[model samples]
Target: MAETTAETTDVASQYSAQVASDLEQNLKEQERLSAEIEALQAQLAALQHNHSVLTNIQQALGTSAAAAVSAAESVTKVPAPRKKTATKAAASRRTKSQKPATATAKRAGKKTAKASQTQSAAQSAAPKLVELVRAHLSAQSEPRSAAEIAAALEQEQPERGIKTTVVRSTLEALVAKNQAQRTKQGSSVFYTSTDTAEPAADGDQSEQPSA
Candidate 1:
């Protein structure tokens, strides 16, 4: 019975030692697991911070891009200064082009007015010239040629510059109006007032001397 008791005590001591070793190994494993968890947490926190920074950078880039687009759109909406200057230049050129035509039209109008005035003056003087010619012819006792009538008119009125052709035309006009009579002697023509002259035959060719 004493031997059995000693064996039982030895068995109990071995079991207690085995139990202590197992407890110590379990504690070490727990410590190692806790250290691993701390490292993993630190890595996770760093990743989250990096993600936040990246997100902020992306947002800033997006805002900058939007601003750039808006600026470009605004620039496109406004017209360029050069285009305005070109439009002004074209308008100025058109004005300059029109100025010459306006000036030419004014000059043409002035010329036409001057011509009308000259024609009116000539018409007004024609009747007085005819009357002067008729009076000179009536004062003569003999028929006078156009040259003699012109010379006499110039001598009577020094201010008058009577031409032979004008005197001839006036005499012809007077003959047409039955205010004067014309005679042709060879190549010379003579004019006399109708009141003081008699009509001659068609075949008669005679020269009369001036009185």
Candidate 2:
């Protein structure tokens, strides 16, 4: 009976030691699982933060792109106010350009008027050349050649540029008007006045062309 009691006590001590070891191993496994769970939670939180940042950046970019498109559209529209301003500027430039043309035209008109007035004054100042020729023909009692009449008129009025050709043309004109007589002796021609009018004083003739 003493031996059996000793064996029973030894078996109980062995079972107590095995139970303590098993309990210690179970606690270590639970600690390792807790650490792994904490690491996985940290990684998940970091991924969520990155996702939020990326979403915000995308939204900001989208807003900026929309604003840029709006600005482009506004520029392309070409509104009425801009058109009116451009038209007014063009009109102003045209008016400025036309001012010189208008001034030039006015100056040209004044010059033309002055030239006309001067020409009229010159015409009024000069005497009719036909009357001088008639008066010279009436003064002669005998028939005279065109050269002789031209020379006499040139001596009488040195300022008058008398020409023989012009005197011949005037004598022909007087014959055509029935105011003088033309006599042809061989190749030479002579003229005499048919009118019985009195003679004029110092007959002045010119080299003016016959009308």
Candidate 3:
């Protein structure tokens, strides 16, 4: 009876020890899972906060860009006060009558030379005016009157300040150069153009043939 009692006691003690060990292992596993869940929650909160901050920053940048674009559009659409501008075209050069050497023949001086250079602008015809007159005369198939040539030059060079005198002088110079012929009847003058003809009869003195 004593021996049976001792055996029974030993078996019960061994079973109790095994159960306690299993319970300890289960508690340790539960603790590990709880810590892992807490870390995950913390990470999720941080991610949500970061996403919100990034979204706000993007919205602010978009608003600023829209404002800048609106400002640029307004600037382009609005007209500024206009500035008045004056033309200096007439002052750029002297008139045709301002260039010649009439006073130098009467009285020669430094002042006279300076005056001559500025005033005697008429003595030498403008190269541009001469060329314009020649081109017009050459293009026409028939003799054009002085008035006709002046009117044509007016259309051709509205910029050079064309006048009747400039055209008349240019035609006369052309006659002198033998590039053209001049015909005068009563008070009317007309120009007849020619091409590569036997060189002028005495080129230097090739003035308009006396009527």
Candidate 4:
């Protein structure tokens, strides 16, 4: 009887120990799962807050873009200012104001044309400087200095305003044309006319009748 009672006590203690160990393991698992749930809840709360902020920014941007488009449309839809109508009195006044300037310009142009014509006629009437220079050189029997020629011409025509520089330039032009000869003697320059004509060609000489 005592032996049967000791076996029953040992089996009861073993069952109780196993039940206590199972309870401890269940508490640890529950703690770990609770911690993971808290971390996941915190991450989910952060993501929701970020999503709310992004939604607000998107709404603000859309409102701003819509407002800008409305403002642009309003500006483009505004009417332009109307031009002033030309009344008969205003037209007459403008014509009167412009007529004097137009008439003045026309008179000025006419006066300029007349003056130019008068100057041209006077120049045409006068002998050319080159002809005068050649005539003076040809009239001289010997080579004449530019100063003497200029002085004689000035004396002959006091109103002509003959300049020595102009005479010298004319002499040089004649020399270039081979119609005058230039000679230098001891720093003094003189010019003489070339009255000799070019020699006739051989064909011309052959065509000429013999005396």
Give Cα distance to truth, residue 143, candidate 4, Å.
Answer: 0.8
- Best candidate, lDDT-wise? 1
Better of 2 and 3 by lDDT: 2
Give the per-residue Cα lDDT of candidate 2 at 137. 80
- Mark the regions of model 3 whose C-alpha exceeds 4 Å error after superposition: 1-127, 196-211
Error of 1 at 86 (Å): 7.6
Considering summed lDDT, which 10 consecutive residues are worst modelled in model 3? 91-100
Residues 1-211 of candidate 2 have per-residue lDDT tens digits of 9999999999999999999889978975774565456445645775786577557655655655565556445544544444877967755665665565556555655665576577568757866556777888888887789889889888976664666766666777788999988888976889888763323212323344568
Give the per-residue lDDT of model 3 (tens digit) for 4-24: 999999999999999999997
TM-score of each: 0.36, 0.36, 0.32, 0.38
Instruction: Give me the candidate number with maximum TM-score.
Output: 4
- Model 2 ranges off by over 4 Å: 1-90, 113-129, 140-143, 152-162, 182-190, 196-211
| Cα distance off (Å), candidate 3, residue 149 | 0.8
lDDT of 4 at 112: 55
Tens digits of per-residue lDDT for model 4 on 19-55?
A: 9999979975875565456545645775786577557
* Candidate 1 lDDT over residue span 1-211, tens digit each: 9999999999999999999999979975875565456545645775786577557655655655565556445544544346878767756665665565556555655665576577568657755778999999888888899899989998987654666666776787799999999888986889999766753432243555447
**Pairwise lDDT winner, candidates 3 and 4:** 4
